[model samples]
Target: MKKRITASLASVLALSTLVACSQAPAGGGEVKSGGEKKEAPAEKVKLSVWHNFSGDDLRAKAVRAQIEKFQKDHPDIELDAQAIPPDGYRQRVKTVAAANEMPDVFFAHAGTGIKEYFDGGLLQPITPLVNKHPEWKNNFMEGALEALSFNNEVYAVPINASVTSLFFYNKSLFEKHGVAVPKTWDELMAAIKTFKEKGVTPISLGNKAAWLAQSSILSSLADRVTGTDWFLKAAKQDGAKFTDPEFVQALTYFKGLADAGAFQQGFNSLDNTQMEQYFIQGKAAMMIDGAWALTNMAATGTKEQLDQVEVTVLPSVPGGKGDPNSLSGGAGGGLAISKKLSGKKLEAAYELIYTVSGPEGMKAVAESNSVVNYKVDVDPTKVTSLFLKAYNLTKQVKFTPVYDAYLSSQGAEAINNGLQELLLGGKPEDIAKKLQDAQAKSLGK
Candidate 1:
């Protein structure tokens, strides 16, 4: 949620293409015999699509490419694609919903946020569409479709699956410092200490935008200590609480990392892109970030540099309730159609969704070093090594949903702000209590 935002020339090109096609000849059929003219064919259906792939990166390019392909395949349909900045995207969608101006199809997350829209009767149920196309639906990974569903109705179609708790480290730096990849909490601390003593930044974190640290680090730490069951119970206000000892211990553990100077100086003032720069420039030994970073690294870093980077789940914690290999991950987000759509407009919107998140689109997503929910065939040589390593690590781990994705908006904000305070010497108990209060209020308890 507003951790960072990126805009690219590809979005501009997409908009330009949409405008250019608006001037093209209409798709209707017309015939004239003698002096009388036959009836004209139906006008092309124009569908407005809003998405957050505004950056000029591989992900954005992949989306644009898919849009072009869709237009080529269906010339009778015109897509008015608008690339919104990610930072304000959620609010923008909310504003549009308030004004009853939601587009025919729009990009949205697959969890609590989307549930809000569904509850408001603003989103279209896509279960029937999925059911009609078994071949298309079967391409998705297990539970993916279900994850995007609410109250037995599917609201969104998952495009990608993202793991946020990955520890991406510079292999060369580890070798230079004589530090092995850590396997346990103790080993991880020792590694941090070693890097610190050698005058190296152990981790690169940027929390000024807030969600970065929560999504990338604390979510995994919480799972390691209290496990996902407790958190889910707490979210539902079903006896579990954030102020429970196990949850507090998780906050304490995260504070310990900050106390040990694991993160770079002024980390809270920097943004995620800046943190990436620190890792890319070798100023920091490792970075805790989402799977999206791998795609960025593949696009910007050299082959050797990309090869030197490796990813792994957070190290095991002693006495932890969760599986040592459990990772904070889930379906990142997906496209949803408006409830008002029907007939040809609905068909065109469904086609757009399928083309972007289906087998063909997923192949492009995989080749760009990103993971997709769709089980598409991809050439191994086309995928980056970083992606392969990350993919393998995910396969070996159990997945815990990302905090913000599962929590109510207010509860999520509370944790994000509370964790930011932890970096400033806030006490674990105090932070835990604050989160508990927020969660209680969100649940109206």
Candidate 2:
């Protein structure tokens, strides 16, 4: 899933723009004891919020409506919402933060990189407000709160929840070729072989951005075949090493998938949109992706075409301790309240967050096949059977946060390079060793 790109970019551009214009956000508001203030009688509060939502057109439309509704409901408060493309989001966030002109509130994840905003006192922590609102946690799944917490404070409200990083396949193709959905690694291999023999691209993958392929496919395999918890613990060097058998086996298994021609030709040349096009067009039999892909596919395909598509978990190895039901993912979309806002503006912001995670916003998201973190009663009528099935499937999983696991400075670069090298024929042991060493060095800082 793509985090709100617009929000980050807004922070980036707004930072410099604000400085160039000699402006400060909401006149440099201060935090009180409870970090909230009553409506200041002197001014009508206006705040800017940013998000990078690059999904369904309907999803964007819904966001627009949500903002309008928020403004209408709280006439004294106004919100400025902006969306940005993912390409420049990180750069924008960094540039804006550097300029000391961040937006009042913006969308961001809840890992080490995301935490840097709060750690540097650039973003406001919402723990006090959250604690006062017990209803907030009720909508969230168990353990979902852990990702947003650091040193005992909650920083963000989770927006999207991932079921599992699995594959999306054309059900029609599977039945036409008489290939059953693979349940185990051997069976998955056989299915791929059958599809290849049938002249169909077994899997369509776009790796141009790197993260898409690594997150949806390689990481899925690593977490499924190896132990998710074990691998994460090992990567951090907390209690295990990358050279452990589990890690090696996982890497080797992924390499085998590559050797068997599992992905489309020249995968390295494709991007997420391009690869998704191939799968939705029926040129590819399956695609390793997340729940977000389902929404993307549905947008391109008609009702009948959508009916022909199905999703399944990543297959497990025969007799492997890893379970096919075990998923690798975390809540993708999250919303955070800024520590800077106090009084009526913050109240309005919190109101917006609550409505979005409440029955209404959650329903709209589910209706589009996007999973939300709030345990808000999902109107089965709003969500497709496919989404319902995926949601239920997550209950069977033994999950470990995938992208959030690597906490070191070199962790991302090392993992990305290691994957590219492994695909280019480097040994699994070498990949693991390099990652371990780089990570160790980062941890020493």
Candidate 3:
């Protein structure tokens, strides 16, 4: 993060950070324009890949199937793909990287998230490969590659649009209970009270990973109170701090929801999947999650259940400084090849990445309710009105910064932990102070 984040810098910070460290990624030569090929390597070449797509959700299923297809299509290449749990994926990858055991290819965020790899030479740039495929390069949504590039070199292929926050509500439930969908802070509170009185969870929240609260809720919620410019300044420690009145106010609003019984019992212990299931099964009236949930809902919910789900942003807060129409979002990362790869191994690694990030792979996930940077036509028959609604919603909104996407590792930990603590009755002012201190130290101030 810099002393200031402009619109361009915000676009750059939009991608996330994932895998880092050392070692393998595979074959990349001429992929048949037909999307079909046979590995011609005289000796079998092995490539290890790591990812966090272990779920029954359509998004995960799409990615898993594509990788399997890649392995099947190239019989002479041994593709070792590891499915790490989402919550622990980054740590496991980093732990390996710290031991200098980076995989041949692994998922990574763009921008400052992967800056260490780009600067340390841990990963190779895919700019040449992208340039080689002009059609493929142009297929990407504008500003997508820029998010993952540094010094005129692009690293990861951004796969998802990665809009971090949205409110998914059971429209029928709201109607049945005579409660309107919240459009203002007071209305939101009223809805929460109404749902609580009716014994239905107002919001199904899953914060076990700590990131859920920050990314899916507070990212946009903070924007509602502090605004994008203030957040950018605060993140960079320019003229603001997390301890400032605006940020503390954001935290207070966040805590207000929790204190008012907005979420389910044991929400902090449950995972996001569980939270989604709670809402899907009608135990909860609403859920606050990212656009990624569209696929999950499409895959897991019955048609009737799916129809009842409606999407919206968090309500406008009083005297908020941010744009009410914006959500915290941007292009997300893709497979990154290791620096160790060269010759046939390098080509193989490129092929391994292209298998998932190229046109075909991008389209498959898009069909599964994911928003991809790659332009691919999705089958309308496979998606629900909710899916289409969410997809179109992304196109219409402005994006605000996602803190972890731009935050230093130390600062990220402090805020994430602080969010959990605040809900458990910790003071917002104290967490704000802790965040300010950790971020200052991280910035070497």
Candidate 4:
């Protein structure tokens, strides 16, 4: 998994070396001139941060408030923040890393995304920090800390956790067509057929944004059929082959949906925002998305829109390995400090993570209809039904696949691209073959 992500990030940042370069070792793990270690001065240091969620109105406001509060408490530390869109954030981070100008503190993913940076020696190990600070350790969610650790070293903090569920059908459309919410793949197909008969598209998908396709559909299907551990292992080729029955089943199911016209025309050109707009405006009957969509659905949807929407996990395939209740999700979205900053900068960085993911920050996240891994005392009244639903579903889900979690940089791109190709025109076995070939080549197997 690590190798796949490395390749993916490398391609994403091919032209931008600034962020990727900091990954290069300047000297040995020890200080030079060397009888004794040389320490850099730590007083009144300023650290820079880069994040993709910076411009999101509510998220931005929450982050800014946290920063302001942190600044007030730690007057000696200064932080500079830059926000970019999530789509372009990876390249920008790579540019900074390549140029050896990484932020002292920045937000990064916990899975393959951070593994590359950690392997490159560009991220600081936070295990000792978490160990020494018992308060931070005690408050984290179960399994949260373990997921963020690579090779026994903690490198990132989880700010939010999400499990991907299959969201489909407008209640109005379903009733109008007399179609029921599906509990199984066959039932879902029936529902799609009903929508098609009523001149409404069954499912709206935007694969133009590559990752969305994997996150929304492929990942969810993998969860339903293979369970999380196997899925993760498969992506890493961890004794699981691309040609495994579960992989074949997922590919076949995905293609069957496409062939049956489950999606609208020009799906290849559609992206997430457009897909969301299609569903929100009632142009489509259903969508497969994450819990984050709730905030948007509520904010932009009308009373009619609100009435028509419902959330649920994807239907199970007949005779699939995983239970219908098992879903896809992980402590994937989170924050981490860059290895670059120290002294006051380091202290300030930790403060930022603590504030956003801690009690006060988590409350804001819950209010925003998001999920986090904090165990702080909560006022149940403060959380929305969306979170409540997601929370319950997450507990039922015992696994998350490796394609999203374990594969290295290179593997992620190959698998995602392979899936896209299968959707476009490639055969399932051909797709699997390509994946096997790519893994063999990339991993030098």
Q: Per-residue alpha-carbon lDDT of model 3 for 1-445, expressed as tens digits?
A: 3556576676665542212111112354334544445465487898899988888777888899989988998898888899988878888877877777789988887555677566667888888888888999999876777768878888888867788788889999999999998999999999999999998889999899898899888899999899888988888899888999999999999999999989888888998888888898888998889887877777688989988888988789999999989778777878888888888778888787788888888888888878876677788887678888888777677777888887788988999999999988899999999999999999998
On the 0 to 100 scale, the lDDT of residue 268 in model 1 is 88
- Against the reference, the lDDT scores of all candidates come to 0.84, 0.71, 0.84, 0.71
lDDT tens per residue, model 2, 1-445: 1467878887899888866445333545553455354444566688787777754466556665666677788767667877776567767877888877787777776556567677767866667667777876666777776777778777776667754476678899999999999888888899999999999999898877666656777666776656667766766678877778877887888788778998887887788878877988888888887777666666666667667667767877755655566666776645676667888877777777766655577667666666666565567776566667676666556555564345465766676667767776778898888777877787772
- Models 1 onward score TM values of 0.88, 0.82, 0.81, 0.81
lDDT of 1 by residue, 1-445 (tens): 2333324566777888896555444544343444234556668998999999888877778887898899899989877998998889999999989998898899888778788788888888888878877898887776676667987877777777867888899999999999999989899899999999999999999888899889989888889888888988888889799889998899889999999999988988998888887897788888999988887777668887788888888888899998778778888778998999999999998888888887788788777777776666668797887888887777667788788887888888888998889898999999888878988898899
Question: What C-alpha lDDT does candidate 2 achieve relative to the native structure?
Answer: 0.71
lDDT of 4 by residue, 95-160 (tens): 887887777777787677787677778888776667776877787666776667788888776776
Residue 29 displacement (Å), model 2: 26
Q: Model 2, which residues run further than 4 Å from truth?
A: 1-42, 54-56, 318-323, 377-388, 404-409
Which residue window of length 10 is worst by lDDT in model 3? 16-25
Count the clashes in each prediction: 1, 12, 12, 34
Ranking by TM-score: 1, 2, 4, 3
lDDT of 2 at 205: 82
Over 4 Å off, model 3: 1-46, 54-56, 72-80, 110-113, 197-199
